[model samples]
Target: MGKPTGFIEYDRIPSPVRDPLTRTRDWNEYSLPMPVVDLQIQAARCMDCGVPFCHTGEEIKNGVSGCPLHNLIPEWNDAVYRGEWREALDLLLKTNNFPEFTGRVCPAPCEGSCTVAISEPAVGIKSIEKAIIDRGFEEGWIQAQAPQKRTGKRIAIIGSGPAGLACADQLNKAAHNVTVFEKSDRIGGLLMYGIPTMKLEKDSINRRVNLMAEEGVEFVTNIEAGKDIPMAQLKAEYDSVVLATGAGNARDVKLPGRDAKGIHFAVDYLTQSIKDNLDNGGVQTLSAEGKNVIVIGGGDTGADCVATALRQGAKSIYQFGLRDKLPDLRAIQNPWPQYPKVFQMDYAHSEAEAVYGADPRQYLVNSTEFIKNEKGELTGLRTIDVDHVDAERNLVEVPNSEKIWDAEIVLIAIGFAGATPSIFKDFKVAKTNRHTIEAAKGFYRTDVEGIFACGDARYGQSLVVTAINEGREAAREVDFYLMGETFLP
Candidate 1:
């Protein structure tokens, strides 16, 4: 530890973000960098606990407790505190393939499980992480480091999201020739499209993708496997195929007027919004401007929709979550070291409240039907309040509690079901009941030989850090399969 009693001397100070009211006017990133001194002070708060659960990366109950990437948190914190910026960056890159991505968007479960959090506020681990990576870039410490030797094996990776990118980076580092395929016009699947620019700017993604390209990894955009290119063709050309396509098949709501205009899935809405912003100079083809937008779901995606709508000048905004409101403090069931299910205002919520003078979230409400006019354009929706029943936490709609609200646009942000089933039609690989690829526990190999699945395609929807872990591990497995020896770590 850089400073043994530093935790006692320093208080937690998070990195500042752009003002909610002012930041909504533009599509730029909202997070502002913390000063080096303040960041170092925050890092000093990392206690020298013998058992640091911050990087345990385990799932307790239904939620992940720590960083899924198993980041060396304390080590990097010590390095940062000692003003060894290069050393901190080195330690960070050893575990996380894309700290810039996870540091921005990942809901830091690492902080939740921090031993310091048991007493005081948790260390600003995510902020420190972003600082280290950002500094690495500014100082030119991060650059293309192509493998000195080649293994002479050709690898084709489907999907260019975090998982696919991480897998490609590792396999390329192991000296294998790797090519990544993406269906979109750009490389990053979720990072490029699904997330709004105010959270993670697209330039960050492009910067990393450029570095990877310079390192000898080939990127093929506007190419989708099982469509323009068949699985059979890839299998014949490449020594092995790794499926890193993310889970983006949105869960549709079956209700009256679901086919109505102005109703869209969250992923589709977000993807289109970002694309329009990039291509059409902020004139969104599918604009939410002046419309009373209703977002049906509660999570980061739904919040993103709310934030995007705000930037597009939405007249009114409302987000409905089926679950009950979380408590202000951790519940008894949610013990220490578990990711706390507590109430906290996310950035989007803050922005919405700044504009609307209220949080805009309605909890414990389930949508019943989408109200629409004869022209089949969404007008609003009906919902009923639900109450929790028994220890099992089953939901029961409260009688005579139906309500309706005025809305012109509806975005379904419920969640993704899993990978697109159509992609697997040609592969003939087994799929789970949940629609994910049927890979063995702790292994990425599919029933079909020479093919493997990882990331959201294998584990369903997960965090960016988890997807990176899946990609790195799958690369190790593929390396072992190709050369009968594994060196990727």
Candidate 2:
């Protein structure tokens, strides 16, 4: 450890956010870089726990903790504390293929399992990671290095999302020719579209894509695998095929008046916004300007919808959550070393508070009906408070609690239920109960030989880091299947 007692001396600090009044006018990232010295101080707080559970992502008794990527947290923290920026970057890149993306958006389960967090606040691990990668980029440390030899094996990776990109990166390093196919206009699937610009700038995604291209990975955009290019053609053209297409189909709310004109899916609204931003310099589809917007669901996607609506000059915004309000502090049930479900405002919530003079969140509420105007356009919604019981574990509306609220535009941001079933059926791949690709335990393979799946398509979730892990693991399986042995670590 570079600083033995640094954890006792320093307090946790995070990066600063842009002022709400000024930042809401543009579609750019709202986070400001913390000073390098301050970042180093934060890195020094990683304690010398005998068993650093932060990197051991195993589910102990069905409750998983720490990073899924098993990042070398304490090692890199020591490197940063010793002012070894390049060493820290080297250590970071060993496991994580895209630290910049994870550092920006990951929920930081590593911090939740931090030994020091049992008493004091956890070390600013995410911030330290961001600083390390940004410093690497600025110092010309990150560059393209193509393999010297070619194995003459070709791999066709379907979908250019995080999982596909990670697989391509690894297979390319093994001297195989790799080409990534994307259905959208851009290479990054969700990162380039689904996420709001205020959280993750498109330029950051572009930088990595460009580097991957330079490293002998071919990117083909605007190519839908099933429709434009048949599955038979891909199998014949390439020796191996990897399905990394994400779980993009959104879960919908089927209440009355669901087909109203102003109602939209979260992914549709977000994807259109990103396309419009890239094409015409601003959002065009589903404008919220001067309209009362009600966003249903209380996850990161919903928060992003709130931020995007605010940027679109919405008249008033309201976010509804089906779950009960969470306590501000950790509860007895959620003890230390577990990822506590406590209340903490995210970036979008903070911005909404500044503009609307109040938090937009309304908990323990569910919409029963969507009110419509004379023209059949959505006008408002009827909502009610609900109670939860273990025996009768369904949302029961409160007595006389129904009320109508203005809602010109409604965005459903409920989470995804599972992966798209069409692609799996087209390829004759099996699925588990969750509708994700059915892979044997610890081995990511499909029913058919020479075909495999991973990432959101396989596990149905996780962080960017977990997606990368799945991709790396699947690539190793493919390698072993091809050559009868693999040296991938």
Candidate 3:
């Protein structure tokens, strides 16, 4: 929109990243910032289509296509193209309460539905977003904007993940006193611990948490609501309560030797790594050095395991997925404007390939059991080939396809099932058959009056953007419940 022919004249460019070999030595962010001028050029690539599917944030069958926060993508893209960074930041913050987190870690479905992507590569919308927020910080434009008047209403938000933070931000803006309770030692919940530092640095989370604190949002850490603190106290003290606790009960693989000592859950391993990196002078309690590491899932968490193992100087690493290899390009079943689940190298896989001789991912493989040593420590794994049929059919394990691979340590990266036990019992919230909080789709309210839920706890989650959207929607509902009206737009 800035220059009528900018989409034709300019090509999409991603932010520069350090060479994989050079970056794995430490747990620091590797993506180098794109220059302001180059970012502007990339922003110029937005066609800002009449339909603007990029901001519609709707899900089509199995895939989501656009920004779930309904971010003013076109407006901000134009503002960035014209060097109005302050305005761009304002527009971004209008919907997404935390751009710093999403800009770094979100998969950027907005690009998948971009009007420009129909013909050519999509504009570097994610990189432009990151640059806008980074520049906002650098130029002192980002600050604490506490409300001038208080409605004298109080709200308690359980869990300090993205959803809770987003809800607190909006509620505070509505002049309500908000307090976020986190079970972990620090705020930011999964953002602080569950995710690896290489992708989203801890400092970025700290920056936002500090700002939120200045804006009068109180954060209490190490006090779990169901255990250390009582849920009755929370319910009695606050006018309303919002349950934003994420779904953290990890799904476990039921194998013959699952009780082996060296086998760990992906969340546990990742949390320990983050704790070691942030607190203990970078001394890891469980190092994968000189060992054969096997990651038993191929999602983002499994990829993170690969990268962390590489950083720990593991001798070898292998990642296994039950599904067949995805096509490098979109398949016939997947059409335009849908997020393609095609094969691509994430940062960790890129780093693993750089250090090892080849990519560490193996498709259509399933771990049968953990092979152990005399001391009951994990020494290796037994795996077999698997075939997926229709939804009604079971996974058929191929005969004569079993194999054993040396594995000193095994990390299970299978996804989570639902919220942890304490959240459900403490709050007494109703749950669906899937064990997630029972909330009608898009309406994040519980059967109990004055109680609400959102994020992974509400919808079981698909992405961080979805969680942010849930938080925004939940805040609107909470506002209406309290004041009989709302102004959350």
Clashes of each: 0, 0, 0
What tens-digit string does per-residue lDDT give for candidate 3 at 241-334?
8999998889999998888888999889989999999889999898899999999998998999999999999999999999888897877778
Best by lDDT: 1
Residue by residue across 1-489, what tens digits does model 2's lDDT show?
A: 878888999999867778987899998888888898988888888886879978987665455578888899999999999899999999999998899888888888888899999898899888888889999999999999999999899998998888899888898888889999999899887888888778888899999999999999999999988668888888899998999988876789999999888999887888888888888778467799999999999888899999999999999999999998789877887776777678989888989999999999999898999989778999999999988866556777789998899999999998887788787767778878888888874678888778889888888855677788888888888878877888776
Worst 10 residues of 1 by lDDT: 420-429
Candidate 2 segments whose C-alpha is farther than 4 A from its true place: 60-64, 390-394
Estimated TM-score per prediction?
0.99, 0.97, 0.97
Alpha-carbon error at 244 in model 1, in Å? 0.6
Question: lDDT tens string, model 1, 40-120?
Answer: 999899986988999999989988998988999999999999999999999999999999999899899999999999988
Worst 10 residues of 3 by lDDT: 387-396
CA lDDT, candidate 2, residue 69: 83
lDDT of 3: 0.88
**Full-model lDDT for every candidate:** 0.92, 0.87, 0.88
Cα deviation at 209, candidate 3, in Å, is 1.0
Span of 10 residues, lowest total lDDT, candidate 2:
56-65
